[model samples]
Target: MMKFKVLFLLTIIGLVTCSVNAQRGVRIGYIDTEYILQNVPEYKEASSQLDKKVQQWKTEIETKLNAIEQKKKELDNESVLLTKELYDERYEDITFEEAEVLDYQQKRFGPEGDLMIQKRQLIEPIQDQIFAAVQEIAETKSYDFVFDKSADVVMLYSAERYDMSEQVLRTITRTSKRSQAKSKKERQELEDEEVVPVVSADKDERQQALEDRKASREEQLAAKREEREKAAEERKQAQQDLRDAKKKEAEERRQKVIDERNARSGSTSNEAKTVESDSTAKAKSIVKADSVKVQGTVKKDSVNSKMPKTAAEIAAEERAQKLKDREARQKELEARKQKIIDQRKKAREERERQVKKNDSIAKAKKNEDNN
Candidate 1:
């Protein structure tokens, strides 16, 4: 009967253990202390103030050192004229000044110095607040263990789902707001303020947030790409329009030149001038012969081809010949322009070389004179 009772007691204990195990499971989370510190405005302000102090101390030290350096330079320059006793006194003064500056630097910034002390003083309260926030979050979220990711404890691999840094920052913000409230009305207002709900370590929620951020980034990229494409298209259209306008202007100029040539030919037609004096006609013949000789050198084949063609055909042939001559003249002009540019480039290079040679000669002579 005693054995049976003992077995019943052991079975009851085992059942209670199984019930407890089923009721609870370990839920671990961690906060990044460095991230928390960066988000805390009070800590940031304190750090900025400390940095200013450090800068001021560094400037002071630099000024003293510069003064010492200037004194040493002056002492070296005047050493030949100075008495031994006076030189020793100035040297001692500079040495002592340097030592003082170094000591001041150490006092302000050394390991056991004011800088470290002020940093600890500024950060301790912030750390306490963080600890309280972390504790509150852990308790409220039913977290079995909460670790500091930025602490000395090494975390080789940590999942993003377990990060609670944002919650800690929110808690800090709320606490600060509550502390700043000076009246019941302000407290009520702060309490009524719409705050973002703290996200727990739910995989679905974290995944959704990540996806939202990714979608937002992609949208921004798409907007920027669309803007770029629009700008590029505008630039391309503007360039094409400019090219078309230039081509139209060139065609107009060519047509105007052809019309002027046709008008001149008609005015100087054989059917019009039948009343010129003999000498004037002779002079005209002389000028015409000279011009024909010049034209013969350029055009081996004459436009006055002896093919019994119609007036319209002759005019078309002449116009075509004129166009070819104009194009040849343009080519010759471009070649001359290129030749002139090359000559100028060569002349410039020669001038530069001559100037360098003269400078070298002058430098050599000056050095010889100095020696």
Candidate 2:
């Protein structure tokens, strides 16, 4: 019985030990990719240099496009001055020139511009190197999956404990430096191969031809520089002419506005003068009428003064005049009030008629349904 109890206790202890091992097998880790990208000097330099080259290419293409546009404009203008026969002959030449310009533009700026593009294509391999380093660190550290906390998918990660970005970045930088040195050595060896020994007549002739070609190229470059400067000056003059034309047009518009304002002011002044003359004539007529009324009043006063003067007559006259004015005002107010009351009654009747008409139509509809 004691042996049986000892065996059962050992089995229980073994089961607990297995459970603890299973729990300990689980692994999790995180890496901050953004931190690595920001901290890595090589990555920063490569990205900045690539951006600068791209900008330079863009500016060169823009200048070429502007030159082509100017040539097209010149060709268009020349076509107007040429005879029909000459125009037809020149048409093919101009078309060929335009095509050549376009082809050159595409060659220099298109997908196959330079070997630098192939160098840029190697960025994927560099990225792969970093990823491989990360994988190595993850596997060596026994991490099941290394999540990037900078990707924002991992809500919480202990910075010191979870980060493997520094390790990966250091590994990548060291590998890239070694690869770059090796590539440079290889390039130097290739460049050395291009140097030929000047022993044969054929080699001497080739060397002379090369020197002549280089001299011719230098002369062509100088001519091109002069042409570019002349073209720049022409463009500046054309821009200045455009500005002057616009300024002249603006001045003409300003003068036109001033002339219109002057005409309007003149018309307004004439209207004011006419109004003043009409007002003077009206004032003269009013003065004449006042004089006539005053003369009539003077005659009546002289007649009344010669006849009689009495206080009771004046009092009766004022009383009668006041009564008449009061009755006239009262009658006007009563007429206005009655007119408003009649309008309101008409509106009420019209509303009632409309309501009745609607009710009759509804009743007819209900009757028709019942039938």
Which is the leading candidate under lDDT?
Answer: 1
Assess the local accuracy of residue 330 in candidate 1 as a C-alpha lDDT between 0 and 100.
51
Clashes of 1: 0
The estimated TM-scores of all candidates read 0.48, 0.34
What is candidate 1's CA lDDT for residue 21?
55
Q: Residue-wise lDDT of candidate 1 within 205-257, one digit each (tens)?
A: 56878999999999999999999999999999998797677657755765675
Q: Which sections of candidate 1 miss by over 4 Å? A: 1-23, 188-371
User: Lowest summed-lDDT stretch of 10 residues in model 1?
Assistant: 270-279
The local distance difference test score of each candidate is 0.78, 0.67
Q: Candidate 2: RMSD over Cα atoms?
A: 34.4
Q: Candidate 1: which pairs clash?
A: none
Worst 10 residues of 2 by lDDT: 193-202
Whole-model alpha-carbon lDDT for candidate 1:
0.78
Clashing pairs in 2: none
